[model samples]
Target: PRLLKAIEQRMEQAQLRYEISGQPARVFSEFLYSTLKTWSRPRRVIAKAEHIGKANPRFVVTSLPQFDVDWKDDVTVLDAKHLYEKVYCARGEMENRIKEQQLDLFADRTSTHWLKSNQLRLWLASMGYVLLNEVRRIGLKGTKLAGAYCGTIREKLLKIGARISISASRSRYRPRIRGRSCSVWSGSGSEFLKHRPISLTPLI
Candidate 1:
């Protein structure tokens, strides 16, 4: 409520559209310096306000000083809006990656009695997510699921019904399709299977 009131008061004044989110919502940011009783001096705070059909406000506090320092000829000093959008937004993306690992890859399944076992499980899940992400970037590029999340890719691509026939010589896989969906499996599905590591057989 306090944050909302602060954002609403700022929204009353003229604000500039600085950055756009994936939802295409225009965000406006402002810097505020405030000092609390626990702090030694005033700290810098960034407030980002967005209005789509409704008001969405967010805030971030940082110790980074505001200066006109330039990193390179092409790179200039970060303003309040630039710092909020670039630095904070990149942090938000990292949070999304963590969520994908935890949710999609079951990284949070730490019910084991041994702490080391649970740590190993979490590490395995994180490694699986990294490998699958690399597959999405390299193999699934230019496809329909190029931008799809890990869960969607797992459900649609990996979790499919198929029949396997194994013999002493080799193994064969036949996908079970309902109707016209077989065409999808015949084209991109076959290509995906060919590229992916379907079996543990060593290549000589």
Candidate 2:
């Protein structure tokens, strides 16, 4: 309840959209409502989320919510690497646990149960990704872009401009350059840019 309340307060200030799952607040609170119940150790609520991602035909999962809220129009989908680590990889572990021990808390014999389980997993993965990114953004402080949105983290932020051009079945992106193509001296060097664009865009 405290965590949910805190998240709600912060969301108001940050204008964030969120929703809660796992179990209802009332259900959780019921266990702690009485002094005797409080004295007893609470049973662990073991809900697991597995990311079906591209393997499934549904939307991508990224984060968990504390309250049901509408999503803002401006939110961008997180990067693929972050999605893999935060969703697919984590879900893989849960799948292993279920198959190995048949100890999944949410698994059911019905197809709807399986579908819900998969969807929940994706949502939780997305939530974890968002939370982790927020921490990174806060820790980095005054550096380039404060948030990690699925691409290389810029060391020294650069200023550039861009224009989008499109044609039938084809689209071209043109970016105005303010500097020369220079070697990046930070971590991974060329390896980071191997899969990502080399052009650095500052979040000023």
Candidate 3:
């Protein structure tokens, strides 16, 4: 009840309100000092009340002093909104990237009984994700799959159905793409493949 009342009071007296970029919500932020029963001293707290259709309030307690402290020449002073939106929100984005790696690149797969082997597996998965990200950055530029997820790219491009013929001199890949998929490949696929040593022979 106390927390709710505090949030409501802050919302009522909100003086700093701004719209976050690329988000439909309005955020109001304020700084206050409060202490929990288990704490020895009052700490600086940042209260952020977000409103889209309904009120959504959040609080963050930090050991960092109030924003009024004098800064050195090279130091940067962080305000409440900057701390919450820039620092905290960026941390959340980093967590999303970690989740993407775990989901798309099988980073969470550690079935090996040995600890060293599991560590090596995780390292390999991380390396694979790095390489895939590089490919997306360089090769998939200006394409529909440029901003696509790793799993989507894997399913659409990497796991494409193809007939492979191997001879003593060379190997040939006849892609089994059709309709829009074929069109997409025909447009930019050759440009993408040009960096590699493989040859793309036109099918008669």
Off by over 4 Å in 3: 7-23, 33-40, 66-72, 142-144, 165-171, 178-204
Model 2 agreement with the true structure over 73-111: per-residue lDDT tens digits: 555443443345565679987676444222222222234
lDDT of 1 by residue, 33-94 (tens): 55556667666778877655455677888877665556664545566787888888899999
After superposition on all C-alphas, the RMSD of every candidate to the true structure, in Å, is 6.4, 21.0, 8.0
How many clashes would you count in candidate 3? 0
Q: What TM-score does each of the candidates earn? A: 0.64, 0.19, 0.66
**Best-first order by TM-score:** 3, 1, 2
| Regions of candidate 1 where Cα sits further than 4 Å from its true position | 1-27, 33-42, 67-76, 166-171, 177-204
Q: Please give the CA lDDT of all the candidate structures.
A: 0.71, 0.38, 0.72
- Of the two candidates 1 and 2, the one with more favorable TM-score, higher being better, is 1
User: Could you give me the TM-score of model 1 versus the true structure?
Assistant: 0.64
TM-score of 2: 0.19
Ten contiguous residues minimizing lDDT sum, candidate 2: 24-33
